[model samples]
Target chain A: MAAQLKGARVALEVDNVTKRFGGLTALDHVSFKVYEGEILGLIGPNGAGKTTMFNVITGVYKPEEGRVIYYGEDITGLKPHVIARKGIARTHQVVKPFNELTVLENAMIGALFGTRHGQITEEEARSIAMEILEFVGLAEKAEEPAKVLNIQEKKRLELARALAEEPRLLLLDEVLAGLNPTEVAHMLDLLRKIRREKGVTMIMIEHVMHAVMNLADRIVVLHFGRKLAEGTPEEVARNPEVIAAYLGDPELALKFVRRLGGV
Target chain B: MNDTIRKLYTRPSALIAWGLVLIFVVVGVLFKAGLVSLNTATIAMDLMVNIGLALSLAIIMSYAGYVSFGHAVFYGLGGFLTGYIVYNAVQTAYTANPQNFNLTFGRALGWWLEGAVLGALASAALAGTVGAAVLRLRGAFFAIATIGLDYAVLYLVKLYHNPLSGSADIPVTQLGAIEGFFYKTYVLVTVFFIVTVIVAYLARVSKFGYGLSAIREDEDAAEVLGVDTTRYKVYAFILSAVLTSLWGSITVWRQNSFGVDIMFSLRESVHMIAMNVIGGLGSFLGPTLGGMVYYALYRATLTKLANSQFIVVGIIVILFISLLPEGLVGLVKLVRPKLRKYID
Candidate 1:
């Protein structure tokens, strides 16, 4: 289940990754291979260490025991910028936008530093940022300060900022967390368009079960910082342990399955 | 250079704002050429240097979002370096070796230039090392660390009695023409102020400037988005320090002597920070505007406003921080957002 990448290139390989916070074991021996041009869903209940997994992958926190291999190179213990420079980009669960900078400026920071090439002109960076903002439907609010954006727009701003990096792999942490249902649907369509059009590899930590079921190509479930289940949406939904750990009630599980267009 | 000038002039109100600043410098020069009393010239000189100091710190604080309460350490070091060099040169030609007299304008000018260059290098090196260590502390912690560093440096100077830095003033009295020195100081101060204004402007509009603002906005996000926060912070600290050191070195030349009290005064750091806060933290015109306004009030009061000038200044600052935290530039943007682009 772990090495099978559907005949696609492996973009990232998290091998036996373990993380700890004092006595708390945040992530323990989690292994996953993200293939090119596919969305890998990372799901779990509260205190399941979903965001910590993203943090470790993005170099925000180092895993105590294992390796984060990106494009066949070991990127463990690298700085966040160094990882970003190596085509790994991530958005925060809390949506950390640059409050004082304009929406476009927030995006340009990504284009300037996150891009694969070094030393781009400001004009080039601005145009690239503008394109990303347009793609995320945030072009209209380019001149406004990031602080002024609504939650959904801020979420889009985060997406645009990460997209501006031109990253080969994008790690999205709870992107659908605070969105309204309509916004979630709109975002789901947008994410599909991103994968379909850009051919990007993605690893997303989401609590929206139906959304993850509909969007992710493969599902990986975590319980108490360990891999509880991994498979297609149908297979994961049928796993009793995953259902008990995450879906909790059988009736709720049926409703979630129904919402994901049923399997 | 052409592009910078174009950017500076094409903005809606840049012409008027720059015109006002240039007019002030022109008027001071006119007064000096007219052989006005040294008192008026001295005050004008003081205004320019204070403006320079205020603008220098704005790059790190306003641009990069690192408040340095011990910023005067660079200024003091630069001043002391110049003082030491000048003292040795003067002592050798006049006292130690009178036969090898070289106190002419040409010789003295050469010495001052060498001193300024040395001062910049020393301050930049120290800032690089110290900023890397201290800048790891964010927000108020970084601010508090700087204050502690300032006090520590002050005490260290007080303890170690060097020819350049000590309780007693070091003599630098071999100037070929005292009047010539003051006039040159005025011009050099103007040049330095303009250069700093450009540096501060470039820091705001350039890609590097944007990266810095990103750090100021949210350091974690900046790093994740690919900004090397550690390296950029140190770069900004060194730039702020070098400019500050240059100002300090020139102050020594104009004043003819310096001591620990005046060279490393905590009061000077307060003035710089207070003026920047009052003007606008990150805006280029903010500190310049704040410097002029504060200087006018100080000069007009004639030391009659209070028992001590600092007490009055401190009270005013407290009011500013509480009531109008955005400062004058923020107030300007609030009233007329359209005009905001021109000032920066």
Candidate 2:
């Protein structure tokens, strides 16, 4: 997997990006590359600017300096919708489903307006939305209003929405955050299926160590608005600094490093 | 054909939209047949104006979730433009050939039609410009900005006198003096009303409408999901402004003259918003229904309550808002959830 990743094309590059909010620096010269068809896990302690990086990449927040290159083009500071049309899709940590719209309708918005938007007719969008809902295991709830969904289902809907956009690069923010072990396992399988079937490159920010550790081809650790470490899961698990960063948060510190001992 | 148009003809939105148009057609036909009294025909015309204005506001307010509190600016601008056109065109013709200054029915009709079309274009231009700026604001800020723009335009119109007329009032009474002018104006308004309904219905069911609905539900999320929020909003605003302006033009032609004070009044803006709120916010049918219900409420209370009719209307609007945020359409959905799909 590591050999293949090294040879794969670079799908996205965050080059020396610095984002500031008021006086405080949220991300300081943070930089990374997301390879094509690879799942790069972004793991960080709380307030480590994980989400801020996602925001910068997604064009929700413009970086004070540096560029977000997607598919060998500088796409920095474009509008969110423009970025979306450029084939970058993201899931919010706090899922934002169109509550009044049906689950199918919610997914349809992605297909109707996302990448290749004007080309896709309403009927085509509907079928695309239905196909996505099926993939996300939300087909049964397709006709129901999104507000009625449980947290897990809502997360799936978020993923479904992003997927329906046909994004080349998918940003998953805490997809497994509030799920139980079984649900997490199910989501992990779904993620694997997505990567395998769609071959879409993904950058997932997760606190669920075991899942990210097992799923990601490579891991990038962030700490206090800076890159703390980057390596394959085994290499990152063995890094003392990465372990030290996790030490402050005991729940992650134990599982994040210790769970990989047997590997 | 829009795939959104269901194969089954029983769709609630389709029924409501076409049914309202049919009513307008019937009234117009009866008026043409001379079976309806002028007073009754005028009342029907007034109802069409009110509903048309409400639906225009609904395109932006309900669908896109941009509550433009100063929507009457477009309405007044329409009237003012029509007045300006009629006064200028007729007066210019008279000056050019005063000896045979014959304001024939065809000439007068030509001026009024020109006024209506020009009014619509001017309104669309203004909305596109203003919406680009004001739509950047959300919620109350956007509403307040619209009100500010409304007053700014109103005061500007108040200050300026047509140099030709040498007065602020630009009377189009000559056009009204033409034979059968009232009935013709009524017919024009009815046609415009039908156009407004069709536009609103199309906006609700189109892919563009879905994008607006997504914006209404959650704007930031919608943008991230690839909806061009700014462009969609401006388009919806233009659609709304143009429709309102057409109504305004027709109305001023019927009234023969308009006062800037009343034309640009915030009261009209509030009424448009009230109608939409009373009916429902987002759906095309909601505002149409709301407009009718609002007009009915006004007529019902006008005789009994005298000057406090609006206060009564205000109380009713507050009741609807507090109890039914979704408005009349919501009430229907609640009663018959089965009918939700049938409705927009």
Q: Write the per-residue lDDT of candidate 2 for residues A1-263, one digit (tens) a residue.
A: 87978888999999999999998898999899999999999998889999999999989999999999999999999999999998999999999999999999999999988887888888899999999999989999998888899999999999999999999999999999899988998898999899989999999999888888888889999999999999888778777798877645545555665665443
Clashing pairs in 1: none
List, residue by residue over B152-250, the lDDT tens digit for candidate 2: 988888777654464566676777667777777777787888778778888888888999999999999999999988899999999989988888887
lDDT of 1 by residue, A88-162 (tens): 888888999998678988898899898644667667888999998888999998888788999999999999999
What is the alpha-carbon lDDT of model 1 when measured against the actual structure? 0.82
Model 1 lDDT per residue over B222-293, tens place: 999899989999998999999999988888887777666777877778878988888877667788778877
TM-score of each: 0.93, 0.94
Task: Specify the highest-TM-score model's number.
Answer: 2
Chain B TM-scores, listed for every candidate in order, come to 0.90, 0.92
lDDT of each: 0.82, 0.87
State each model's C-alpha RMSD to the native. 2.7, 2.4
What's the true lDDT of residue A148 in model 2?
Answer: 94
